[model samples]
Structure formats: structure tokens, C-alpha cells
Target: MEIKLVKAIPGDVLLLHDVQTRAFQPLLEKYLDYEKNPANEPINRLFEKIQYSSFFKMVVDQKCVGGIRIVARNNSYWISPIFVLPEFQGKGIAQQAICQVEEIFTKHNIWELQTILEEQGNCYLYEKLGYERTDFEQVVNDRMTLVGYRKIKN
Candidate 1:
């Protein structure tokens, strides 16, 4: 399977929104009450974020199966939301996307991301890709707990 990372444009806002919603539907169903999920964001809000962040489409064999959004803060790259369509989860597309971002954002000395504490798969994926879980977490309401991770370049 071939994977590629491409910069996203304004035209992809709706596509990204759809991917985000479809990918997180299972999590929403599992938790049954996660209002803080990225998939819960409105399309207009996604458009606003796309305007400022480095948005990328995770393309596989010429199809878009996922996307990631990275933002800059205090010289560190923050990968806020990375979504892979449920159908595409087993593949290594998301990992490839993360590697691509590491290459693309080479100027940054540090990278960070956050995810729901219960998402073992996401936590494993980030850790395998060199991110270290920080000793910080937040209780997002009763149904959700957020965990943070960071990777610093040597």
C-alpha cells in the first residue's frame, strides 16, 4: 500500500470534516457521551482551524483515508487531531502521516499531541513513533479523560 502526505487546501474542509466525523463515530458510540471529541466540532470551526494550521491529507493508493492537523505554539508543533477512517485503521497510514509531518516540520524542535486517555491504540501509535506520554492529564467531564504526549528532537 502506497501512502503520501499532501498539504490540504480550503476545498478539502468538508472532506476532512466528513472523515473526522466518520472516524470518530465509533468512539462516540463507545463512550456514549463524548462532546469533547474532535469529531463533534462543526464544519465552520474546522474551516477556521484549517486557515491557520498545517493541514494534511493522508492519501493511500490515491485515496484519502485520513487527515491530520498540526499547529504551532511556542516553537513546538501541536498535532491536535489525527483521524483515520474506521475502514483504514488497521493499515499504517496514520504512522506514515506522522513521519511525514516530522519531516515537513523539521524546523520545530519539539512536537506534541493529545488524545482521549482511553484510546490505547492512539497512545501506542504515538509512543511507537517516538512520542513520550507526559505526566499530565485532564478530566474532560465525567466521560472523557485527556492525555498529553510530547517528542523532542535531539
Candidate 2:
């Protein structure tokens, strides 16, 4: 169960998009977050993301199980999206991936991300990983809200 994060290349866009869609589909269906769900994003959008962000393939035993997208500015880093396929979730892959990404960006002292406020599991995972909830919250709909989190390393 070796988990690895490989820098994604442009040619990997289609595969990454497919994995992203599969990973986010259940959440999209449950939340009906049509405008913000990565499941509804076009392949071209993912391709563009690969060009600008530090997109990495979440590989386990040489198989691409999911991906994580990171945006960096100065000493801060933002993890916009991180997902594992439905079948791959709960295997601690995402946790390991996040740790690895943070290690890879050793110079970064501030890390931030957002997740659905209603999803306790998601919030718990981030909290367990040392992310503290920020006061910021975005109401996505009547049923869903996005909450921000941040972790600062000393």
C-alpha cells in the first residue's frame, strides 16, 4: 500500500479528469452543487489547471487513484481540491497524499483549504490533520455551506 504523489503532466488531463469526476460524483449528487462541483468541470478546465497549479496524481501501487490540486503564493499554499475514487476512499490515501504534498512544499508555512460545512467527515478529516476552521464561510445553497480552514506551521 505504497501511496505516492506524482506531478501530473498535460497528457494526463483526461485520466485525471475521469478520476476527479468519479471521486466527486457522489458529493455532487448529494449536495447538488452544480456550479462548484469538479464532477461537472470540463476536461479543458482540468487541462488548464494542470498548467497553473501543482496538480498531482494520487498513485497507489502504481495506479492512479485520484488527484490533489495545489496553488502556492509566497509562503502560503492552498489545497483547492483533493479526492480519491469512491472505491479508494477511507483507505487513508488522501491523508497520506496531503502529508506528502505538505512535505514536498517544505518552504510553505501556511496551508489552507475548504470543504462543505455540512460534511462532518470532511471537516473531521481536515481537523484531524491539524487544520483549524477559519471564520470564513460561503453559503452555497440552502442545504450546503463551504467553510475555510487553515494550518500554520511554526
Candidate 3:
């Protein structure tokens, strides 16, 4: 399958919103109030928040299949809400998206990457890509766990 990472377009916001909500539905259902009331946040609000991020990227074939948002803080880049459509999972869409985002971060001399995940498999993916666990954990929603990771280099 052909894949390309591109700067997000205005029209792509709604698509990303759908992908994120679906891709993360299982996890969010157990941990977020928004899951109880999906109707609350306007799609435009989601778009605006993503648009304001310094590092926002999307992967597309004919349309957005996955995306990632990053923010720079304290010399480290924080990756949030990386998601691939449920139908596209295990097709390497997420791995490619992460690599593309990391390339941009590296070009800016941002060598450290940070993220939090709730699953061991997610942690394994990051570990295989050279991320180290800082042994930090936080409980959100009183029912879900967040495990933090940091990568110092490519």
C-alpha cells in the first residue's frame, strides 16, 4: 500500500476527528468523560486545538488514515493522540506516522520524544523503536493507567 505523510489540511480535520474517536474509542470509553458525552465537543474545537499545535501531521492514502500531534516542552517533544483508523491497524500506518513525525523533530534539533501509553504492546512498539520508560505512571479516570516513555535519539 502506498502511504504519504502530509501537513493536515482544513478539510482533513473532521476526518481526523472521526479516526481519533473511533481508533481510541475502546480506551477512552474506560477513561474519559468525553466518552460519555461525545456530542459535547464541536468538531471545530477539536480542529482548532490540533491546528494550534506546533507539530501536527497526518498520514493519507486517499484520505487521512492516521495522524499524530506533537508539542515541544523542556527540550522534549510530547506526542499525543497518535491514531490509525481501526481498519488500518497492524498495517504499519502508525509506525510510519511516528517515523515521519520524528524526522521533523530531528530536523529541528529536537532529539527527545515523549509519550504515554496504557497498553504493553504500545510500550513494546516504542521500546523496539528505542524509547525508554521513565518508570512514571499516572492513573486517569481512576480506571486507566498511563505509562510514560522518552526517546533520546532516532
TM-score: which candidate is best?
2
Q: Candidate 3: RMSD over Cα atoms?
A: 3.3
**Separate clash counts for every candidate:** 0, 0, 0
lDDT per residue as tens, model 1, 16-97: 9998999888988777655677768889888888887888888887888988989989889999789999998978888888
Give the winner by TM-score: 1 or 3.
1
Every model's Cα RMSD, please? 1.4, 1.0, 3.3
| lDDT of prediction 2 | 0.92
TM-score per candidate? 0.93, 0.96, 0.78
User: Candidate 1 regions off by >4 Å?
Assistant: none
- Which residue pairs show collisions in model 3? none
TM-score sort, best first:
2, 1, 3
Q: Write the per-residue lDDT of candidate 3 for residues 50-153, one digit (tens) a residue.
A: 67875344555467776677777676777766767678877777777777778767644433433436566677778887777877776555656666777776
TM-score of 3: 0.78
Highest lDDT scorer: 2
